[model samples]
Target: MTGKSLADYQKEYERIIFFDQPRKDILLEGLQTEMEKQFKLPMRSKEWKKENQKIIAMYRKIVITRTL
Candidate 1:
């Protein structure tokens, strides 16, 4: 029941968006790593376009909010 406050979490998230590199870059890199593990691929290829699109779409849907 004890952890970082909502504001602190939101700040961290925003930092990732603003101070960090482009969101797409981060998302694609992580997605590529995961897809590589799941599919045993050595690297992302043109064939993975659809999977990448789906992952990016889902990533955009995530919402972070603050309540206080």
Candidate 2:
């Protein structure tokens, strides 16, 4: 976050998150599905609060725009 913009970080985040699916497909064989669910469960809750909400929302917007 020092020299990079949120958009750049968002790109990297997307890359890592996207990379995870194929990695899990090859390595974990769906075993970590529950773990991923557990991890995402609180992301929309009060766990992250307002600060991260802005960032995540921004990332989601970027991803949505890219997909469309």
Instruction: Tell me each candidate's TM-score.
Output: 0.31, 0.30
CA lDDT for candidate 1: 0.42
Best by lDDT: 2
Weakest ten-residue segment in model 1 by summed lDDT: 59-68
lDDT of 2 by residue, 1-68 (tens): 13445565555455544554556243332323332343342545665645466555654543443322
Error at 27, model 2, angstroms: 27
Per residue, candidate 1 scores C-alpha lDDT tens digits across 3-56 of 443344334445544433456456445544444454444234656646565543
lDDT (C-alpha) at residue 30 in model 1: 54
Find the candidate with the highest TM-score and give its number. 1
In candidate 1, stretches whose alpha carbon ends up further than 4 angstroms from where it belongs are 1-21, 43-68
